[model samples]
Target chain A: MFDWLQHFADWLIFTVFNIDAGTKLGTALNFFVYDTIKIMILLFVIVFIMGIVNTYFPIEQLKNYLNKKKLYGLEYVFSAIFGAITPFCSCSSVPLFIGFVQGGIPLGVTFSFLITSPLVNEVAIAMFLGMFGLKATLIYAFSGILLGTIGGWLLGKMNLEPLLSDWVKEILKLKMQQTSYQKEQQTFYQRLPEITRAATDIVKGVLLYVIIGIAIGAIMHGYVPENFFNQYLGGGQWWTVPLAVILAVPMYANAAGIVPVIQVFVAKGVPLGTAIAFMMATVGLSIPEATLLKKVMSLKLITLFFAVVTICIIISGYVFNLLL
Target chain B: MSKVIKVLGTGCPKCKAMTQVVTDVISKHNIDATVEKVEDIIEIMKYNVMTTPALLVDDTICIKGRVPSQDEVFTFLSNNE
Candidate 1:
């Protein structure tokens, strides 16, 4: 009777979920379910916590503490560390950037957030671990943090304030208007709904993108040709990094969406550097991300952001190729 | 009826420049039009554009994926008008 009940349950689950019984489809379906649940729940939890932090911590205090121009290097390090822990995409990171700026965080420090947010995220880390193992994931994560810190500090030192749009400057000027409304003054209990609302807003905004990204990733995993990478990007030629970056520019997809493609490339014996470059290009500098960034940044700053990220990805890819 | 032109982006400089150029062109031609900037991603995505710095005139996508020169934009506006 127990055996029969088990069989019945299996049949019910298979029919309802359309899960394959025992094949790659089954494996893929299991992976999808596990990954989706893990990602969504993790995202909700982290964002909720961050939202609470945002609400109660008073970015103003943090900003006031770090506002000295000379301490910009330390601010960059802080931003990079925070960025490494928070798994935000380019589009998702903007609101946080606004929060940081409105909170009076330095431009370069906020830039560190922008830089590391998408490039090295928890989702990317998990996927990297699952696909490429722990060593690669650790290296990628560490390097990403380093890059974010250095890039932000360097840009901060350049004093590119002149390149800012008049409107942004205007917005900055108006920052003093709301200095009195401090959310942090509220008790933690009072801030719960605010945290919930912020998390919900973030999830609502980003969930669609995540679904689309995962769907595309699943499709690529199941359908794309194994040897396609070998045919297109397998050469050890020096120009492949730039070529890959150029190819990735016009396309709009996220890191999760491109991981399956990277897996295929690795499986097909593409050089590690070239494949990493392609992944970074597609994930870090997507068209959608650029479009989203256009709302807050000026053209010159946007161009600089793209250039810096692309160069970093290329360098990282080369390093990976040399070492591994 | 005045034509409405919207520059869609995240309020970045190029997006601002695009808005400026469009406004400049409309004013120079004495065309009765309202130029606005759309910074919301969902609203921008409604037009099926994957790139930023896009221009929309009368709710139609006129230029996409690149920042247009002032003359190019004028020609676009005039041709559409």
Candidate 2:
């Protein structure tokens, strides 16, 4: 088993590093630069497109339309789908949340949006496509949407509105103060500023996280032990999935920054599901995002959100392992 | 002297809340202080605060982890004065 693992790690390292038995150091440096630039440019394009989409779409109208009484399950699914398209992160989602709530969109549907917005962002989608190909990217995106919708529906069924902050409730109460006339009077084109503001805000907000995440990924690509994960996290170990999730909890980074790391892990024989789960947990449920969320959500709701998302990622990880 | 109260964050809700709270507290207390929302990471890094919603008073990190309560703000400014 040890020798097989070592061989696997070596194979992976060679494939990822693009190094032959006797490749020069300059070749390796060249490969790193080429990969990093390609990845970064892809990220920039995707984010820019997402920004344009976010800028052009009128989410408030959509939220209002969805606010009507309907089947909870379907609403949750649609919420997640909508979230996937929106270019907002957790921070940028705040104004949208406020808009949704004031528009009378159910808490659960809003939760779906909240969950999916950060989990299946454009940057992640682009990175996944770049590293894992279109099929894998599509799978991850669809799964994220599924998780977001299901999670939101579950939370909505719990009827946790009473648990909301007094301020939020107050905001809800004053919803009527701004009449629909005030809202409908503004066309989608007129809302460009708001969309631009949200896009720029999200980019600015997550830029550091992305940069740091990518930098870490670059270093891992360059020097982290190839077999480190296989030695520690492989072989259907009972502790592996939970341990990966726990380890990922305190880290505050983005998916784009971590994709290269994920590639490295997969190269080294780290279980596919475990690696993906670790990535999801680290990127989606970042410590900083959680800490920032605490200002808006109560401890109870936050804990529940965390638990639901963690379970989903774990299950997804296990499923990947089972299938792949 | 202008009492400087800095709200540290990358322009998230908590940072916005901290800015509001500081503004509210200063107004309520009628203190002659200016509240500046610091969105630049470098400026925030100078204070060595990693968390958002950090509150700094005249360069001292008054609150590092959580949003300061109204009472806590009162005591902090009072003590500083």
Candidate 3:
């Protein structure tokens, strides 16, 4: 479908710079052109659709659904899935967490949403498809959801709700007072322009990341040695996984924002598993997010959440390296 | 015309900060302005502000993607006026 764009890039590089197709410069230019257009188009379309769909899917339902869970294992599963589709960031995750707790959702189930939402979302999936292909993306999505479910289930058994902050308890008391709050009926007419605005806003925000990521990836594809990172960061080295998680914890970037960096890392021969671990760590367990959660959660629960998720990611990284 | 200041977000912390900044600016300046907080995801999209905590003064996007301090809000309202 994008063959014409690829050809245009090739011809431009050859004609303008007199560089042949086989040369390193030509290859880099080719990669940059092809990927830039591909990822941007995919980002706009996917984010637009997601925006429209998100408009229709009221968040109140999520709170209500988790609150009324009668199914045995399905609540955790569904919460993880819901976490993936929600169009908010780590910033929104806190209030959503408080909302869930106040709505009577289990703390474990809430944890499941908090962990998975930032790690694997629609933007991440689209970017991965443009950069890494389907298999790696599936691995990321699978591990993210699984970690949330298993982690939440285990934490549920521990029953850590007593550790919630006093402010949250007061909020629950107020929610009890407002027991008969009315729900608004949604209409398609009301959602149409809002959807377009969302699409435009998202596209504007991430376009630069896509460009920068593809640019660096292309440059790395042409210039970087194939074996540059093989000795230390490669899949063959088991410690690289944990090492990546540790390094990534302090960095702050959403999945979309960090793709270009991930592209450069992977292209320089960083193992896919190690690279994914880094990405998850940057998005899911960053310092700011932990600080925000501290507003409502005790230090012990926050520590446990971080420790459990970090361990899960490090383990998944090792498993992927071994399998792939 | 009373200036309309809309803070675009889903009521997150950053959004609250933006809202507070606008409120303080308005009261501090004694300006005739209406401050509205748009928490609905779709309503936020209407302004085409990607990051939450976007501030709009009379339909012009003045600040976005981060929280603005009271001084910044003061400057924005002054400029709009």
Candidate 4:
């Protein structure tokens, strides 16, 4: 992938410090610089493209499509696939979920979208590709999407719409208000400044987190003994998977911020499966997201949702650790 | 004279509430202005706004990260106008 970045970092380190770049400290320093620069460039370029796509992808069409679907497996698949692309925030997805429910989308289909949208997004893809290489990146993306699809399917089969909170049911009865917008046509020529501006905005938002994550990673890279975690973490161990999932569920962060830290974890000999499971849990599930989901779902249903995702993630972590 | 008021957001609830506030202020004053909701993340960034529920009056950033009251929105409009 970005082998050039390593060479560049090596040159910079050797030229500045007059030290052998292959030494332990130099290698860690080079890793930090290479990854930070790579991720920064990736975030800017990918986010810019995503912004443009978001502008052209009409929300109305997606809603209409979800509303019209009647088949079970096909609808779930379509919803999960669409959800995989639509980037989501902890709070933003709630209102959109409300709209979906109000539009008469089935419980399971909507859940599929909500669960998959945040977990399997493009930003994560770019981060994984840059940090974990192609093979691992593909495995991560595939497992994430598959986990969402299967989890949603199983939940839907349970027919638990009655478990929705009373307030959610009441809102469904009321006519959802649609906000109309005056058309604003923009050409590709006009989008140049907009793309740069968006890239800058996104960088500004995540820059601090990214720096902190990378800093922590650099420290770990320098200080941790190689394969220091063999006894504590391995596929052969049963507790490692659940331990990773439990540790990851409470702390939430964007993929851009967390991937740097995960890179260090993998370097520190965290099992590939456990590290990825942690990534999915931290990025996909969070307290704020749970609080928002609570507004529309009963305590029981919320518990069920969390439980399902946790189990799936733990299973993935253990399976990958063994296979890889 | 007319003005263009842009609400920069990702179409979240806070963004929607701010849009409603701006809409109400415009109607109450009967102001001769065009209100546009910039829901596209890319479009919203043209103003260098990092946070949502941002109010931009005629290309100048007014309020960001929170919804201003209708009275506050009125002041923003009147001052800009």
Real contacts retained, model 1: 0.00
Model 3: runs farther than 4 Å from truth?
A: A179-190, A254-257, B1-81
Mind giving the per-residue lDDT tens digits that candidate 4 earns over B1-81? Answer: 799888887777668878988999899999888999887543443344334567778877776554566766777788734
Q: What is the TM-score of chain B alone in each candidate?
A: 0.88, 0.89, 0.90, 0.94
Chain A TM-score vs. truth, each candidate? 0.67, 0.79, 0.90, 0.91
For all candidates, state DockQ relative to the true structure: 0.02, 0.03, 0.07, 0.09
* CAPRI verdict (incorrect, acceptable, medium, high) for model 2: incorrect
lDDT of 3 at A280: 83
lDDT of 3: 0.74
Scored against the native two-chain complex, candidate 1 gets a DockQ of: 0.02
Model 2: CA > 4 A from native:
A1-21, A24-27, A69-72, A179-228, B1-81
In order, the Cα lDDT scores of the candidates are 0.64, 0.67, 0.74, 0.74
Candidate ranking under TM-score, highest first, comes to: 4, 3, 2, 1
Return the lDDT, model 2, position B8: 72
lDDT of 4: 0.74
Taking the tens digit of each residue's C-alpha lDDT, what string does model 3 give over A1-324? 667877777777887777898899889887888788778877877787776665456666667877876979889988887887776756666667776776788899988888888888667877887778878888888888988887777788887988877766666566343222223233566545545655666677777766776777788788887778776577576678888888887666545756766776787778787878888887778787887778778999999999889888898888777777
Quickly count the clashes in candidate 2: 2
Question: Backbone clashes in each candidate structure, one number apiece?
Answer: 12, 2, 1, 0
- Summing lDDT over every window of 10 consecutive residues in candidate 2 chain B, give the lowest-scoring window: B42-51
